[model samples]
Target chain A: MSTQMLTYLFVGLSFALYVGIAIWSRASSTKDFYVAGGGVHPLVNGMATAADWMSAASFISMAGIISFIGRDGSVYLLGWTGGYVLLALLLAPYLRKFGRFTVPDFIGERYYSQTARIVAVICLIFVSFTYVAGQMRGVGIVFSRFLEVEVSTGVIIGMAVVFMYSVLGGMKGITYTQVAQYCVLIFAYMVPAIFISIMITDNPIPQLGFGSEVNDGSGLSVLQKLDGVLLDLGFSAYTEGSKSTIDVFAITAALMFGTAGLPHVLVRFFTVPKVSDARLSAGYALAFIAILYTTAPAVASFARLNLVDTVHNTAYADAPEWFGNWESTGLIAWQDKNNDGIMQYGAGAALSPIKPSFDGNTGVHGERLLSNQPTESTNEVYIDRDIMVLANPEIAGLPGWVIALVAAGGVAAALSTAAGLLLVISSAISHDLLKKTLLPKITEKQELLYARMAAAVAVCIAGLFGIYPPAFVAQVVAFAFGLAAASLFPALLLGIFSKRANKEGAIAGMLVGLVFTFTYIAYFKFVAPELNNTEHWLWGISPEGIGTIGMLLNFAIAISVSRVTAKPPQSVEELVDNIRIPSGAKAATEH
Target chain B: MNSDEHTKQASDVSQIDNQKNYWKANLKLLAKLLVVWFTVSFGCGIILADWLDQFSVFGFKLGFWFAQQGAIYVFVALIFVYARQMKLLDRQFGVGDENDADQESQS
Candidate 1:
């Protein structure tokens, strides 16, 4: 079949599977809606968490970013996965033992303050909204490229599909659908990588192929060859990093803490049957995620190598099919600056500044060959990073079926994460704000109704964000992690670890952290983009890295304030002791 | 009622010891696991990466592999180990039962 037909078929079938799971597992009660009735097996919950956690950024853009940036991209790989360690060790089991339906439930009950819970809810909504916008845009991008529809239309379709499952089945449907998505996404990601690995290096495993000798009888390792090529083109060595070590450290720390605090991911643990299961499930989630994370570096290296070899010094007329294909999508472009017919792509001018070789000789179409060269020209080819993964199969000359699978995988990634984030947004509004605070007398059935309605509303807003994304939306998504790390993680950790931490301390600390991180990100990302450079950053800490300092500030302030504040009530102390023991975690329905 | 009280009084000493031992053991285990976590993720993965890159493992620079793959593998192992060890600790303290454990205020 043709590529378009295959993509439609695979994507259609996956959507059908998700909707089918939703119909089969539709929830009848709030317990089922919120925590899948708290009966999911540890391994199953793990797979679902993996799917929910690995959003479009991880599945679609991560390898592409790594491909271009090379060694500097390790921050993402290490930071994203390393946070699970913190989650499993410090947070998951204890929170699961607390047996709450949402994160705010824990904060409210633990701090014995509705205000604290509201503060947490605000943070959750902000972070989840920022994240879901990216997912919606991702879905739109995939649809526009693969399905040949407008971005706005794609987002509406996406919203309709998500509404079907999430409103009907809530966490239960989203969980099972994510498991299916995990399978689809991982299979799609690995197949092309394996084929390309074998084709280029005679190594079947992409991970090993990344380091193996090239098959061109050059006897040089793949990394060695890539480094030589990139360095010759005035770029840094591909195997080594060019980022400041402090910035790398700070960015990695921010991501790790952020991952640990993300409300949607933490909610997955609430679905499992036991506290022990939560711990084991986290390990399982990481194991599942590592399958793709480990392969990503290999994909990055292979894509970079393939791109550089295929395009360097090739005439525009002789350029390969995939190059032209991506160019039609407007993701890749070329301009013959010197009228040399061949396109140049490098760091441009700083290393090998162009000299005017033109003698005013005109050729066909009034184009002068080598005579009108710009004195300082360097770059000629413009390649978008987002295209690398999407165009990988085409670049490698893989069959139409594999190319179709990549489209399905990208959609699955975006939809799964969007579903997860939407659930968190809905739950925060319905469970935290309306039911818990405004209408405590509301029935369970009524609360569930509110949750569904909230979900629909959230999806519509998210679609709007996707269609008309603000200028800073993409950059703001990065700060969602920073905000979570700065605001929520500190409060959650201190609430559990320090029994002396009171409502005043928790609320004060969260507000200070949230405001501090937000002001920093806003100032740099929107208010003063020019001042965002390393020279102007505080201690060379970019806004992405500023969260680390914000987190530290939260810890210090919370501890000092708690020292002077009134101690928690005796019942709250008992609650803390109870969570620490973790021997009597109740059913989700017990709430 | 007198016999019940007597049994409760008798078990309190042993129960206190069990609880203390369990809590102590849990914290100790967490400390050890956390040290390893910090060592692999921050130590070998970042601070000591260049130094460790002097050696190669399975056709990968030791530090680069740690930054990308090794830390994640160790993190998975550590969590499972912690879970298994915590289970034993809970059972040892006779606190593993769902209903009988931490029932002080719930009833």
Candidate 2:
């Protein structure tokens, strides 16, 4: 069958499975709605959480980003996965013992203040929305490219599918669906890796394939050949530090802490029965996620080698239809600088033209990369990072069904994460903000109705954002680490560990961290244009890294202010003791 | 003699709940965690990266591999240690499960 037909078949079959599960496992009570009735096996919850955690960012954009940056990409591999370690160790079990349905509840009770709870809610909304926006956009990109639809239409369709399952079954549906998604996405990711590994290194395992001998009798490993080729092409050695080491280190830290603090991810721990289960679940989740995280570097290195080999020193620099195909999508762009009619890996300036060379002379080349794609012929490349996962099969010339499977997997990753994040936002709004705070008298049935309404509304808002995301925003993803690092990480780490963390301190910390980080991002990314591009951003720490600084300030100010304020009282102290002592944990705690 | 035994039992509960020593225990755990988090990330990736890059693993520089892969492996190991230690510490303070091997189910 044609790739298009196969894509439709795969997407349809996967969607059908989710809807079927949602129908079969519709949540009957608020407990089930929130934690799948707290009956999930630890390993099952771990698999679901892994699926929920790995987004389109990890599945698609990550390796592509790595292929471009080479060595710097390891920061992402480390940063994103490292957070899981922190989550498992520092937060997950304690919070699970706290026995709360939402992150805000723990914050509110831990700090003994309503305002603190509200602030955590705000932070949860901010981080989850920023994350959900990217997933929604991913859905659009996958649909438009493979299913032959408008990006906006794709977004709306994806939103509706998520709304149906999540509204009907809440965590119940989302957990099982994510398990399926984990299977689909992992299979989708690994098949191509195995194919490419076999084709290149004669080894089927990506982890070992990276270190094994080169297929050609070159007497050097594939990595060694890669280094030689990259350096020969004016690129830094493939594994050398090309990024500002400080920026790489700071960004990795921010991402790691942010991952640990993200509400939707930590909330998965509550789905298991016991604190010990929470700890064990985390180990299992990491193991499942490792299947892909460990394989990613190998995929990146191989893709970089394949891409360069295809285009470098060849008569057909862009003969592969892959280049033009992705170029039209506006992700990949090549400028014929010096009119050398070749692409080179060098310093950005040497390879860049100050003006567009697409009108064959005076027109723009990079901005609207798709519109003027060297129409009549010479090889000008413009492939996007998101294309890496999708194009992996094609780049290696795998079976057509394998390419279809990739498209399905990308959607699965995006949809699973979107469902998980959307549930957090909706629950926080309806269960925490509305029912608990605004209308405490609402019946359980009525609250369930509003929860469904909240999920639907969130889906609509997310769909809109996916369509017309703001200027200077490179798709809703660029904000993930920054927002999480700034607002959520400090509050979470402090609330549990520090006895002096009072209400005023927690609120002040969150507000200050959020405003400072947000404003800093706005200035560099969006505002500097109107303000004359000033060299004033406190050591050029872009919005992404600004969070690390903001988080530190949050810690300092929170404790400083707390020292001068009232301590949480004797009863609140008792509550803390109770939470830490698992044997005394109650199924329900009213006070 | 019975009255004397009752007084000793009361002292036992007080010792288990002693706020000062509990805080000290929590502090110890925090210090250990910070060391692990800091060493694996800052040490493996940045401060020692240059010197360590002199060594190579699987033809990849040591620092780069640590920055990318080794630190992550260490991080995974750290969590397992943290979990095991916390469980033990909880047991020492009478804060752990009364039944170690028993599992509970809810209706």
Candidate 3:
């Protein structure tokens, strides 16, 4: 069978499986919809959480980004995973003991104010939407690349699949389907990595192969060879980072805090049966996630080495099949700056505009003619970082089946995360906004109907974002993490840890953190892109790292404000005391 | 009647004291574990990465390995340890899940 046939078969089978689970696990009550009846096994919830947490960015773009940036990429590796430590230690168990339907429920109840819940809802919407847009776009990219369909068609199909499961069976359906997705994505990720590892270093384990010597006659280790090659091409050593230490520190901290704060991830713990289950499941989730995280850097190094070996100084017509295949997808392009008819891969940007603007005509060597002016740099290739993982199998000459599996894996990663985010969005709207605040007297059946309706609308909006992606879709992702870290994380922490944190203090802290982080990011990213570098950044903290400072400010302000404000009521204090214990964590309740 | 009231008051005080002790112990455990977490991730992974990278183990740079791999392993271990210890703590304080139904009935 052709590669396309295999891709269709795998993707079709995955979709059918998801739809089947949705039908089998159709939510009968609000409890089933919201928290999967709050009886999910720890291991199952852990795998589902792994699937939800590893979005298209982790699955598709991370390794490629790491390959380009080298040691600086450790910031992402550490930042994304280290947050789980915070989650397991400080947040998950206590929240589970609270036994609420949504995060805002905790905020509303603990702070004893509707205003606080509204603020949390706003923050959740902002973060989830921004993050979901990326996932939707990822779905579109995978569909277009693998299925030979238009991006919009791909997005619509993805939205339909998500709608079928999430709207039908809610969290129960999403959870089981995500377990399947976790298996598909992890297997897809590992297969090519193992193949490449053996091909490059004679070691089957990508993790060990990363540190082992190159299989070729060169006596150099993989890292040493990578460092040498990158430096020879005028790039920084692959083992050394170019980012300033302070900037790296701040960015890592921001991401760590942000990861711990994300609503979709935190909500997963609520599905487990008990407080200890929450803690145990967080450990399992991280262990599952770490498998891919540890393998990514190794994959990055191997792909970089392979790319350079395969393409550098190679004749345009003789370039590997994967190069041209990706080129047609507009992710890879070439220009003959020296008219040498050979491709040059180097450090600097090949085109002045960074992204290639293809012209209608083909060049003398049949390369795509680009309207982009060639830069003074010797680099003559433009490779989109998102293609690294998807193109890896082809680059290494793996079987067509492996390539097809990668396509399915990418779709699974995107769809699973998208479904999780949409669920949170709908729950915030139906449970928090409508039932809790607006229509408190509504019946449970009415509320469930509204939840499904809200999910349907949210899925459509998400699909629209995928089809007509905003110009800032990529840039706004920083907003999601930044806002979550600066606002929700501090508020939740204070509400749990400090009983004196009244409504006034919690409200003030969230607004201050949200507004401050938003202004800083917008100023640097939109207002003055030229001044976004270290010299102009406040205290050597880039906009990406400003969330760390924002988080600190939130902590300080909340603590001080609570000192001045009236102490929380006695009942609220009792609530805090209750959540601290491990027993009596019944199923998540509407009340 | 006076003696009965006094005994009930005494038990209430003891229960409060037990809860307080449990909280204190939980905090102490968290502090110790968090210190180790900080040492592995921020202290070694970031602050001391360059210094530690001066040494290599089995062709892997020590600090880089910590940043990329070792810290994640430690994080997983920490959570499991926390879960196990918290379970024991729950049992010790008579707040284990098995006692949940009993507590609910009394309430």
Q: What Cα-based lDDT does every candidate model obtain?
A: 0.86, 0.77, 0.91
lDDT of 3 at A588: 32
| Cα interface RMSD of each candidate | 3.2, 3.1, 2.0
Winner by lDDT:
3
| Residues A28-60, model 1: lDDT tens digits | 888888889888999999999999999999998
- Per residue, candidate 3 scores C-alpha lDDT tens digits across A340-361 of 9999889899997998878878
RMSD (Å) per prediction: 4.5, 4.4, 2.2
Off by over 4 Å in 3: A587-590, B1-10, B101-107
lDDT of 1 by residue, B1-107 (tens): 47757986989878667766776787798899989988998888888888998998876778888887788788888888988888788787766634532343345
Docking class of predicted structure 2: acceptable
DockQ of 2: 0.38
True contacts reproduced, candidate 3: 0.67
Number of clashes in model 2?
Answer: 3
Compose the digit string of candidate 2's lDDT tens values, residues A1-591: 888899999998988998888898898877778778877888899999989999988998898888778777877888888888878867887788788788998887787777788888988998898888888888888887778888898888888788878989999989999999999999999999999999889999987787777788887877789889877766677777765666776777778888888989998998887777787789888878878887888898888888777765433344466655554554555655335545543323321332223332222322223223233333344455677777778777788799889989999999999999999998898888987788999988888888888988888888888898754335336666777778878887777677677777888888888888888776766656454232564664545566788888888878888888888778766666666555533353212
Off by over 4 Å in 1: A348-377, A587-589, B1-17, B97-107
Candidate 1 colliding pairs: A358-A371
Each prediction's TM-score against the native?
Answer: 0.93, 0.90, 0.98
DockQ of each: 0.45, 0.38, 0.58
